[model samples]
Target: MTGGERRPVASRLAIRFAIILALALLPAGVIAFIKTDALESEVEARNEAALMGATVQAAMAETGLIRRVRGMVASLSHLTPTVINDPAACSELMRGVAEEEPTASLVAFVPVSGVMTCSSAGRTYAFSGNPLFEKVVRLREPGFVVNPRGPVSGTSVLGISHPVLGAAGDFMGYVVVSLSHNALNELRLDTFDSTHGSTAAPVEFWTFDRDGTLLTSNLDLAAAAKRVPASRPLAEFVGTGSTVVQDTSRDGQKMSYAIVPIVPGDLYLMSAFRRELTDVGGGLSAYMPTLLMWLIGLVAAGLAAEFLVTRHVRTLNRAIVSFARGDRRLQAIDLDNAPVELQELASAYTAMTESITRSEAELEDSVHQKEVLLREVHHRVKNNLQLISSIMNIQLRSAESAEAKTLLRNLQERIMSLATVHRGLYQTSGLADVRARELIPDILRQITSISSGPEKPFVTETDIDDLRLVPDQAIPLSLLLAEALTNAMKHAGATRDRPGKLRVRLKRSGGSEAILQVSNSRPDVSMRARIPASSTGIGTQLIMAFVQQLGGRTDSGEDDAEYHMRVTFPVSPLVTAENRERNEASSDKLGNDPV
Candidate 1:
């Protein structure tokens, strides 16, 4: 019975339970999915701000450089020719201005007709045809020009010219500040600080004029920096507020840019990066927070299935197994802290188990009560029969005729046999079935005493294997055995010459058949006679009827030195009608009994 206990089909049940949890996580996945486009839009907006800010800050630095150059040029106008006569003094003034600004390479005074006087390099120059000289003298104000070569460095330079005005407000020579190529490049990416090598997208910085001429670029873009056509997007977008656009670069790399008009009259600042430079989608890093949250939600769902959802399901599985194995006292699952759906399931299971336990208790109580009533009825029947037997004995003692006394004794013997069957039932543990080995011996012993006389001194021997039968079957079998024993004691002789003997054996050996054998130590077939005889024709008929009722075959006669009877029967149907008859009889007795 222990080995036959069934184990849970864990794999199949786990899959079933997991599907329910998976269903619960489906909505979370949908919500995360639904948020995707909005989240990406939000991220794109922020990235645009950052890119525009980078370009603005860098352009501001360049604006600062241009401002400083104008300041330097204006300062030189204050230096007197009295100071210029002391060449050391004019050179000192010029060197001091150059050292104060990173972009300034030279500071000098150039006449309106284009002659350099009191230069920072300490040399004079003639520039009669200089366009900037004529422009500054004509305008009498600050002006700027990009020059490929300058009087000092001979490299590409930007010159800031501030015209010196006379006391009558007449424009005179110009105060010039010169910046070279190295200094202009310093302004290209002054504010964009991220390491380019570490970035996923390749970035570029460019500055262009309103007329579409590319001025300077952080990239190696000289070859690609042709004049912007009127049809290009940049031409229309130059004076607009800071904005982002997706377009192709000169090299045809797909790019997204944030463009803003930098200071100094429609000079545009642009910060750009490749849109498809990496195998992974570009600019997705900007939406990392949203993506990370989605991933976290997914991971949380999996953990919840393992720790919270599936764990409770497995617990329920074990609880069911224990309860089915007769643990009636098992506790109900706790619902207070459980998930809502699981709590409802647990509540249903608890109610179902409690119902089963209540039914089992009711059934057990009903069976116990039936057994108690049955035992009581059997005991009462035995007592009633005994009273009748007692009355018969008294009548027999005073009977006048010898034949009447003999009839009374036989009647007493039969009544006693019936009484013994009740005694067997009442004494049984459940008051239900009777054991054949036990019942037969008790019946035979009583009959032996009834038939024995001091002169007869009947001898009996027995060997019976234990078997159980119910009251109805026991009654007939008991009567049969009593009759046989009575016959053995009366006729199968006893005196000192030959003592009477009866031996009975009942057994089953490794098969479904039961055998009962009774042998008397007397010659059953002899005309000359052996032992003594008394005729009782009714005993033979009674024995045959009882055997037929038991569904058994019987043979009785002489076998060598002993007279024997053997009954053979199947080991099934030992109870038969006995249980049904008992149930009906109990119902009647209980129904009629007063409280």
Candidate 2:
């Protein structure tokens, strides 16, 4: 490509191949990603389900304990009114019952007077301000309450209460059983450890009443509260039917909690499991294989394109470039180990180059023959013009009149100038064009030698640049220069005994024009007076004619000391092969005619 030309973005075959390969694999990559996402979702769902199952299993122990407590409370409610009302006898009976049930912290019976008449610890208690007492009295049914410290037991406990009735079914009293919070926690941990292995992740268990009051927890109150979902109340999950949810704990750890009701509107159990249960590492690891496959496929495709196509294309391109830069060796491209298609293309290229080489060889030989014939023609023309000049010279020597001899001499000089032009043409290497630096100086030397005598010898100075011109411009240009020089030399004279000075210059003017100038010292006053008369002479007329033929303009003027003549013309552009052929055809049609 040229320096200013831009290579297109899509032109690189390797990159195009890589893009195509990537597009081809796009569906597979998308499918892989989708499958990986689905798999991660499935794993998450299964993990949540397993956590919910484990939480329910752990709550089973609490459920059975509550059931047994309810059965005992119901059984003890049947105590006779005489035993329930008698403080000492009822205290002995409650102590015995508390001893029989290991889970109960305190068992008490309060009569209708709002004072605890029966106690497991053998102590009298007042129920005037107890919330459980009011609840049991108002509802007249069995219920449970959570207390951080029970009034009777002086410790955190779950208070289970059942209303007692008299023989007549009248409201008489109620029975209250308090379960120790420490024992309940211990039992829950033991059940969890047995259900899940001891090495499994530690789980935090919390039990709350329908009022959102925490009853008991495996962890301390503050720590366990931190694990609860901050966005919702525990009462909101009371009847949610074994739901598992994800939330960030207050301590900034991610936790998955399963909420299961141990007693449907009375108590709830929530288990907090570690975050890893539903974590799939953000599903990035699952896409590793797809990403790796895409990379490998792109790389493999690029390599294959480079080896199979691009390398051979580059090889062919280099060979073509080398050939175009004039490397004649035709065997530069190696076809061995190339693919079949590339081999065929190389063979076709080789054939084409071979044909072009043969055509060039034939054309060169034909051009050589034409150049030889044209040079011979110029040589013969130069010889004939020289013969004509010699004849004119001999005729001038025998002339009888001064005017006739002068005229003969002038004609002879003009004939000799033509001969010089022909000679320059045949002598140079090129047939179609001549160099100004070579031919112009030679013409100047010849004219100066002929015009100089022993008494009036002239000094010539020339400044010429090398410029090539076709024969059409070169012929007229040479004739114009000869005429101008002859006219300048005719009246050249010494000033103060110095030799007559002549200066000739040929150079490029603008980028497309050339200037030729000839200047000579002015003659004596007597000779200068005849200049106006001589301006209409045959020499000046011929100079004008030659300039016209060259499609140029001319100027002639005399300054204080010297006479100057100049011709300025557009320079012919360098001849391309088409122009050269056209020039040759026109030259052939002209048939070697004298200019």
Candidate 3:
């Protein structure tokens, strides 16, 4: 697998998990918060309504008690002056009213003489028994009192008083009726309990006087009343509307207090509310569904991610392996559905593979063309050398003198030596170097066979190997060797009876020079210039030219009946002039039109 394909699953999973978590948490948390907020708002609305109803019921009940007591007082005030002057008749009237109206705790009638009398519980009481009656008798008009007592028994009640007068419109006395506070308290408590029982949260009922004095609450009334400051800010809201809400506390636990304004704003303020119902965020039940949704969504997204990652990696791996196996023609992997990084990886892989394919094709074509050109060059050189050898052979057959015939034979051998070099080049892929040891002996043998007459027994011999020459230097050196060997064979000859040996040894004296020495047992140095001065043999002149061209020195020596012709040439050419000439000749042969 390639580097991209080898990406670890742990990293990929971590990235995917992070994305899914973000997606799940951001929306789910927001929705849950909104839902919680909505629930709190709804609960607050319900609490407000409940509080308003409780406050209204308490106010109605309290006001009705005052009104009922006042009505009773008005009825008694009309019969008061007649009944009051006669206490017995007044007691009868008061007792009859009290028994009929069970809500009235007591009844009283006071005379203009400032004496009060009361009837309750089947007994009558005199006004002198209670000091509160004295204060009421001094009143000029009708009035109501809170938490009053009966005229004689001192029974606590909510009381009201009205004036009673004679037919002459003179003030005679007053009448009083008391309503029971305990019955009103019981009714208020029952209504609050009923309203509170129908709700999921706690509900409170608070009643305060106009000065914000706490009167009633679902909590410990006396304790709550003490905690409520006698002078509170609710006095400023005496005339406000019903159902005012604010987050507050009764005894330090958090609560929402809703203040409901009662009717007759001058009397008192009644409030009802709940506590410990604020939205604290995520209800446990709500999280069950939210978590389930998040988990489901995360799983689906993870599966999709795995599929995409696997597909992209597999495609990249296939393409990479194909390229490794020398198949550069693979198509690019398409990772559009995959991640952006994998897409880039695929594109880079395709570009690199395409580049390699083009380079390989170009290299292969270049090598093929080089091989073809090399083979063509060697073939042409072989043909040209053969042409030169054939031309020399034609020249030798038309020669007249024995000297010319010998020279012609030597020229043919020189051309043949150059042909042998071409043969080596044409036969092998490497055209530049020819093995000279094998090549020289083969050339000398050809020369001996061509020049030998029927009676002559000439043999070419040499102990030579491990020698190499480049074609450029070998051609000229071959010509020089051919000339020396041919001279020994033809001019320094032994007859059949003599059976003389001509020894030819080609050896390297040092690392730098090739030494060709041809020695014959028979000594005939005078025979070397047998090609006369008057005659211009082509081979003789060419031999001298080739020797000079090779930059070599030649010497003819004799010792002990052996004639030695030693020619020493540098291992390589002194200059590239010969190479240049060869190039020009090759070019001329290639571009020249055949004649």
Residue lDDT tens for model 2, 1-595: 7525899967789989999999999999999999988887887777667777777776667767877888788878887366864678888888888898888999988777787768897777788877766776887877777777788778888878787888899978778789997777777643343223354566688888777877777777767888887777787887677788888777777887888877788778898876764454555776788899999999999999988889999889889888888877878578557899999999899999999998677666666778788899999999999899888888988999988987887777777787888888898787667888888888888777776777767889999998888778878888888888887777786543667889999889989888899999988776667554544378878888988887789887888889898889888775653367655755654565566
lDDT tens digits by residue: candidate 3, 1-595: 4544676665675356647665757776679757766776676566567555655664565555555665667777877666655667778888888887776776776665554544544453455545556666676577645443444445545566788878899877777777665554554544334334554443345455455544334455555553332334657666676655554444444444455554345345444344434333324553566567666667777766667676677778777877787776667477767888888888888888888888667555554565467677767887887798788778878888977876666556766766766666566544446676667777777667666655666655687756676666667777776766666665555456444466777788787887778787663455434533443455567667877876788878887677788778777633354355345545554565476
Q: What is the C-alpha RMSD, rounded to one decimal, of candidate 1?
A: 17.7
Q: Which parts of model 2 have CA positions greater than 4 angstroms off?
A: 2-9, 24-284, 332-341, 387-401, 453-461, 491-501, 509-511, 519-527, 530-532, 555-566, 576-595
Candidate 1: misplaced stretches above 4 Å? 1-12, 15-314, 317-321, 335-345, 400-402, 509-512, 523-536, 572-595
Q: What is the C-alpha lDDT of each candidate?
A: 0.70, 0.79, 0.62
In what order do the candidates fall by TM-score, top score first?
Answer: 2, 1, 3
Top candidate, metric lDDT: 2
lDDT of 3 at 524: 48
Highest TM-score against the true fold, candidate: 2
lDDT ranking from best candidate downward: 2, 1, 3
Q: What is the lDDT of residue 533 in candidate 3?
A: 41
Q: Is 1 or 2 the stronger prediction by TM-score?
A: 2
